[model samples]
Target: MNQELISHDGPGHRWLAERQVAGVKLGLERVKNLLKRMGDPQDTPAVAIVAGTNGKGSTSAMLAALCDEAGLQVGHFTSPHLVETRERYRVNGRCISAEQLDAALVHVRDCAGSDLAVTPFEVMAAAAYWLFRDLDLAVMEVGLGGRLDATNVTDPIVAVITQIARDHTRVLGDTLAAIAQEKVAVARQGRPVVMAHPTVTLAALRRIGLTCPVRKVGKDVQVQDVRIGGAGLGTQAVLRGRALSEPLQIELSLPGRHQLNNAAAAVLAYQEICAAWPKAWPDAVEVVWRLAEVPWPARLEVIETSPMMIVDGAHNTAGMRALAETMAERGKRWQVVLSVRDNRDPEPLIRELSAVSEGFWLPRMQADRMWDPHKLAEVIDLCAPHADVAVGSAQGCFEEARRQAHRSCGVVVTGSLYGIGEWLGRGEIVSPRLRRWLDGQAPQDQ
Candidate 1:
C-alpha cells in the first residue's frame, strides 16, 4: 500500500491500513478462506473477470455499462483507484457511499478474525463481493495476473483478456507468452474466454494449456473502419461479431484506437453472459450504442481545454505505446508531466513517449515505489536527447509544464495512475471523498 492511502483516519481505514504490513501476497488461499467466512458472497452473483496488462480497466468499465444497459444491476470492482478508494466499488455506475464501504469493511474485519490472514487487496475484494451479493452481476478487473489473483475465486460466466504485454516482469516473467499464461488461467473449461489482443492467438493459448473456448477479436469479434477521432473526441467503429445479431455501429467515449479492442472484448463477454442466462439479453442495437456513454477515468481524460490538459494512466510500455499512437494519429506533440512506479523498466516507456513529446517534466509522486525524478530525467536524456527536461515537486513540474504547453503544445500528465490521482486531487477534477482525503479529514469529519 502507498503511504498516502494508509493515512486516512477511520476504524475501517485503519484496519485496511494495518494490513499493508503484509504487503501483496499473490495467492488465493487466504482470500478464498476469508470470503468463505463471509458466506461466499462472490458465488451469489454472475461474474466476468477481466485480465490484461493495459486495457483491463476500460474493458471492465465497458462491460459493466453494457450490462447496466441490459437492465441488470451491475457491481464493478477495479484496483489502484485514481482519486478515491471508494471508486473501486460501484453499482450501476454510481460509487457506493463511504458509509456503505466502511460498514462492509467492518463486517469484513469481523469475519476475518485473528486466525485468518489476509492482504489489503483481499479485504477490499471480500468487501466488494459482500456489498454486491444482491446485485444481478459483477465485473471484476484483476489486480494482478489472473490464475492466483484473489478475484479469481468466483466462477465467471465469461472471462476477458485485453491486450496482454510485458508487465510486472519481476513477478509474471519477462515475456509476453509467460504473461499471457498467467492471464488466461482465469478461464474455466465450460466458459468462454474472450481474447482481444492480436498477439495472443488461439494457438498461443492452446500452448499455454487452455481448455476453454477462445473468442478472438479479429475472428469472433471484428472491429472495422476504425476512425480515430480528432482532438477532444473518441474513436468510432463498426462492430461485427459472431455473438451479435448483426454488425453494429459503435462510438467509444474513451479516446485512443487501442480501446477498439477493449470494446470488442466487452461486447463478446456480454454476449457470452446472454448465452447462459438468455433473459439477460437486451436489444442489441440499443445497448451496443451505449458504448459511447461508458465513463472510465484517466485514459486520455481531458481536464482542461485552452492549452489542453489531459491525464492518462499510461505507466507501462504497452500503455505508453498506445498513448503515443493516439498522439501520432492526431499529429499533436505534447509537453508531458510524468512519473512511473519504480518496479517498471522505464526505458521502453520513455522511448515510446519521447517520440510524440515536445519535452518532459518529471514530477515527484507521493506514493510507494515511485521513480526518483532525477533518475527518470537521466533516462529521458538518454532516450530523447533533443527534448528539454525538468525535475521538481509535483506542483512545480505541473505548473512549469502547463506554462510551456500553453505557449506551444498541449499538456499531458501520465506514467502512473497514482501520479494522476495526486494531480487530480490538486485540480478542479476532484471527487468529494478525494478532496477530504487530500485535506486530511475523515469523510464525516468534514
Candidate 2:
C-alpha cells in the first residue's frame, strides 16, 4: 500500500483504514446509534453544521477560528484532511492528539458493542462528539450530502451552506436543484440557515420544505468590493449583515474571491449561534475578523517559494473554476501536477487547469479510486489539444513540473486533497512529529 494514502501507521489509524473498503454509506442510522451508545455527547455543544459542494471546509475552519478568537471553547471537525486523519478534529485550533484519537476510538468501540457495523467516518464523528462534549461550540463539516451525513446527527444551533455545486452527483443527485435540496436539509425549522451559494434561491429552499429562516449572502448578508490580493495577500472584502451594526471589513487568509462569501457566511453563522445562546457568548464577545491568520491546509497552500509551488485541493469543476480564476488574476500560467479521483469528470477539470497551465503532469496519486495517469492524460488531450501534458509517478511529475516552472511560471499541485497528503508524506511540508508517525513510529515513541 502507498504509505501516503494510508492515514498514519498507528494501530488505530490502520484500523480506521481497514474500514475504508465499505466506502461511503450515506445514512444517519449507524452514526446516530453509535453516538446514542456513547451517551449522546452531541447534545451538549452549540453545533454549527456546514454543508456544501465546495468552500465548506474554509467556512467551518473560519467559523471555528472566529469562535476561538472570541475566547470560546470550540471544536472543529472537517474531512479529507491534507496532512493526517487526526486533522479532521480540532480543539481550540489544534488537532486532536494521536493518543487521544486512539483512546476515543477504543471507547467508541466499547460503546458500539460487537454487532453494530460502523464506517470509519461514523466512528470518527462519534469520537469527535465524545471528545468535544465539554466544548462551548462545535463546527462540524458534512462529509457528504447533508440529509444523511454522519454529522447530521447533531441538531445544530445554526447551519451553513457554502457554494453548493454539482459534485457528488451519484449520491447527492445529478441536478443542481437536487444537490441544493440535499444540502439545505441540515437546517432545522425555526433555526437560522446561512446560505452562501449564489445558485440556490430562497424560493427553491422553501419549495424543498425549508422552514428555517434563511440568511443568504447578497440578501441577508451583503459582501462588496471583493479584492483578490494575489496569492499570499489573501482576499479582501467589506461585509454587511444583520448581526453587524456597521459594515465589517474582512481579509481572509484563505485565497480566491470565492472565499469572500465563505467568510461572510462563517461570520454570520458565528453571530447567529451567539444570538441563539447569548449567555454562552457574552455581549462582550466581539466579532474578531482575524481570518487572515487562519491556516486551512491544501487550499491554495504555498509549500515552496523558489518556483512558487502552490498546492490546492480543487477536486471538482466548481473548485477548479475558482482556482483557475485565482491563477489568472496572478498573471502567470502554472506548470500543473494534477490527479483526480476516479469518480470525477476529468473534462472540466482538465479544461480549467489547461487555461492556467503552461504544461500538465498527470501523476499517479497514492489514494484509492484514482484516475489512471495515462488514461487521464487521454482526457487532457481532448480538453486542451494544444497543451503540453505528460504522465509519470508522483515524485517524478512534481520534480519535472518544478524544473519546468523554474523558468518564469509557477507550479500548482492540485486535483485532490489526498494528492496533497501524498506530497506531505514525501517530506514536502509535513511536520516532524507527523513525519515520524507517517514513518511507522508510534506517538509514544515519537
Candidate 3:
C-alpha cells in the first residue's frame, strides 16, 4: 500500500485508536498475563524507566540519547506523539524501523488474539517489549500514573522520577500526596532512583526512599558546571565522586531554560547508568553532544520568521511555571495561543503567565474535558488584568493572532500539548520526530 493510504481511516490507526486502555489496571497481572502468553521479553531488561508530572519526554529523549552515546543499542518508548505514532517507539536514536514495528505487532496480535482485550497502551507496550527485547537497551516512559502504567512491566537498572505535580485528578487522585503515591509506586525494589526537587507527597518520597533506595537529583547528582551559548549547551554532572562535565558553550535548538533543567536531570540519569554499567558507558563528550542533538518539540519551538510562531505543552501548574520562568528569562515578548484544562486552577497559572505572555483572541479552550477557554480568559482578566487572553481553537486563534501580532513580537501556542499538536499539525511545522511519527515513515538508515 502507498504510504498515503495509511491514515486514521486505515485499520492500523483505527485498531489502536478505537479501543481504550484502562488508565489504572491496578496491577501488572494483565501485562504479565499478556507477556506470559507472548513470552516475557521485559522481565530483566537493562532499562531506564522515567516517571514524572512534566519533562517525561525531554527526560526520556535525553536518556535515550545519552545511552546511545554510551554505545548501547537503545530502545525508547514515549507517548502522544506531536506528529506520528512511530515517534512513540525508537531504537538507537531513531524511530523504530517499519520492518521492526511490523514484526513486533504481528507477534503481539497473534498472542493477544482474544485474551488481551486490554487498552491501546497495553498493546503498544507489548509491541515495544517485543522490539526492545531484540535491542541492547530499554528506556521506557510511563504513560500515565506510574503504579499501574503499562511500561512498569519492565524491570529497570535505573528507575527515574523527573518531578512531582498533579494533572489528571480523576484517574490518579484528588490530592497531590495521593497522585505522588500512584506515581512512586512504579519504583521497584533495589533500583537506584533519581529525581528533581519533589514537593508533592512526603509519604510517597519516604516510601520510595525506604522501598526503592532513591537519590534526590541535586543531592545525589548535581550540576557542577554549565555553559549556555547559542546552538548548543553543556553541563557537568557531579556523578558520585567523579565530575562528569563536558564543557560545551551553546544554546539548545529546542529553546527555554526549562530544557536546561531537563538536561540536568538527564545528565544525572546518564551518570547513574554509567556507574551501573561502566563497560557500556562512553566518554562524557559524546554523551553531551547526543543530549544536545535530541529533538523535543513544542518547548519554545520557533517555526516562523515574520512573527515567529512558537508552541509548548504547558498543560499543568508545574509546566505553566516552567513556561513562565522560561519566558521571563528570554525577555523576548510574545502573544499566546492559549487553552487550559477545566480541572486546573486558573488563578495561579494566570498570575504567572501574566508576567510574560497574553491571550490572542478567545476567552479559553474548547469544551473538551477540563478545558474552558472562556473561563481562562476571565481568569486572565481577574489575575493579570493587563495580559490579553485569546479565546478560540488553535487554528482560529492562531490566524487572528498572526494578523494582529506585531512583526517584532512573537506568537506562542501553549497551555496544552493538545493545542500545540493541533496548531503545529495544521501549520505543518512541528518537530521532525512528531511529523515523521504522524506520517509513519521509517527514518532512513542514519
Candidate 4:
C-alpha cells in the first residue's frame, strides 16, 4: 500500500506487499482461500489462538513469554504494533528480525498474485505460520471479529477469549453474546476454549459448550487473587477439582486494572499446556514472574521528558476510562495527540479525554480510515473547550507540540494503535538522549 513497501524486503513488508483488496465482512473464505494456496501452513504448529474486545496483545505477549520461559522456541504474532510492523512477529520472546521478515515477505509476495482478493491479515497469518512452522509454540492474535478473523485459520490448542464488550458490534454483531459467539468460533476440538468473560458473557459461552470445552476464568481457573499496583497479581489455576498453586508472584510493568485478566488468561493457558504436555512446564514461580514482566506499547507507556511523551491505543470509551484512572493516579499536566478511525465512538471519547488533558492536537496518522484532522479538531473543540487545541496533519502538529514541550510539560499521542505505530516506527523521533539524561527530570504524561 506504500511506495517503499511495494516489493520491499522489510519486516512485515509482506503485509504491505500483499493485496489489501480483502473484503471486510465476517467470513473465513478469504483466509481459507489464502491458506489453501499456501499449502496449509497453519496446521503445522502447536497453536494457541487469542481473541477478545481488548487485551489480546498483552495476553499474546504473556503467552509468548511463558513459552520462552518453558525452554521452547515460541512465536507470537499480534496485530497493530506500537513501533515497528516486526513487533507483530516475535520468535522466542524476540521480534522477528527485519531480514528474516523480508525474506519471508519475498516468498509470500511472489506466490500471491494481484487477482487474489485476500486481506492483508490473511497474508500475515500465512506468513507467521510459514515462519513459525519450525517453532515449538505459537500464539496468534486475531485482527478483527474472531469468527472469520485471519488468525482463525489454525487449529488452536487453546482458544483464549479475553473479556468481551460492545466494541466492533457492527461487523461481529450487536449483542455481547453474539460477539462472544462470533469470537469463540476459533476454538478447536477438545482443547479448552478459555475466557475471562463476566457471568452473563460466560452464560453465552456456556451455550456453545456442547460443541467445545468452555473454560471460564473466574469459574474455571479463577484469578483467585491479585495484588493492587504494578507488582501484578497472585493467581490460582483451578480446573475441575484440581488447583495449581502459585510458585511465584506476577509483576506487571504495564498499568491498568484490566491487565490482571490478561495475566490470568496467560497463566491459565500455560497451565492448560502443562496439562497436555506436563514435561514442558516451567517452575511455577518462574512462570508467574515471566508473566509479570511483559512489555507492550501504548497501554500505559510513559516517555520520560519534561512534560512526558505518553502513547496509548485507547480507541474506545472503555479504554479512555482506563486511561483516565491511570493518569489521575500516576502523573499530571499533559497535552494530548489524538485521532480515530471510522466506526469508533469518537465524540464520547473526546469528551472523556479532554477533561484530563491541558491541550489537544489532532492529526492524520497514516490510516486510510482515520478521521480527518478538521473533523477531529471540531469534535475536540466542543468536548474540551477549556484546553488549547491545534489541528493539522499529525506530523506538523506533533512537530509543533515537540517545539512547545519543556521540562514542565508533556505530550500523549493516542486514539489509535495505527497512529502510534506509524509515529514510533517512522524512526523520526527516538529521543535517546531524553531517556539517558532527561529521564524524569521533566514533567511526563501519557
> What are the per-residue Cα lDDT tens digits for candidate 1 across 1-446?
13444433567777987787889889999998999899999999999999989899999988998888888999999988765577788888777776778788889999999988799899999998998999989899999988888899988999998888888887887888888888888888778988887466455567766678777888887889988755675689998867678888999878878888899888888888888885747856879767786766777876667767777889888899888887776555689888888877789998998878988998776666789989989999999887899988877886788788876658877788777776676562433433443344422244
- Candidate 2 — worst ten consecutive residues by lDDT sum? 437-446
Better of 2 and 4 by TM-score: 2
Q: What is the TM-score of each candidate against the true structure?
A: 0.92, 0.91, 0.83, 0.82
lDDT of 2 by residue, 153-195 (tens): 8778999988878888988889888888888888887889888
Could you tell me which residue pairs clash in candidate 2? Answer: none
Best by TM-score: 1
Q: Cα RMSD to native, each candidate?
A: 3.9, 4.0, 4.4, 5.8
Model 4 lDDT per residue over 1-446, tens place? 12223333554474555455454545678667766777777777789889988788888888778777778888889876554445567776556666777777656665665566666667667788889988878899998878778788776788888877778777878888888887777776577867777554556555666356666666545553444432121222222213346333556656566776677777778877777764757645566656445666566666544546666778877678767655554444567788787768688788777666777877666657778877877787788888788887657877777766563246767787666656655653453322221122211121
Which one is best on lDDT? 1
In TM-score terms, candidate 1 sits at 0.92
Instruction: Predict model 1's lDDT versus the native.
Output: 0.81
**Against the unseen true structure, what C-alpha lDDT does each candidate score?**
0.81, 0.78, 0.65, 0.67
Ranking by lDDT: 1, 2, 4, 3
Q: Candidate 4 versus the native: TM-score?
A: 0.82
Clashing pairs for model 4 are: 248-285, 306-442, 306-443, 307-409, 307-410, 307-443, 308-410, 308-444
lDDT of 3 by residue, 229-339 (tens): 331222233233233464433334455556666666777677778888848566565556565456666655555646656667777778888777665544445677676
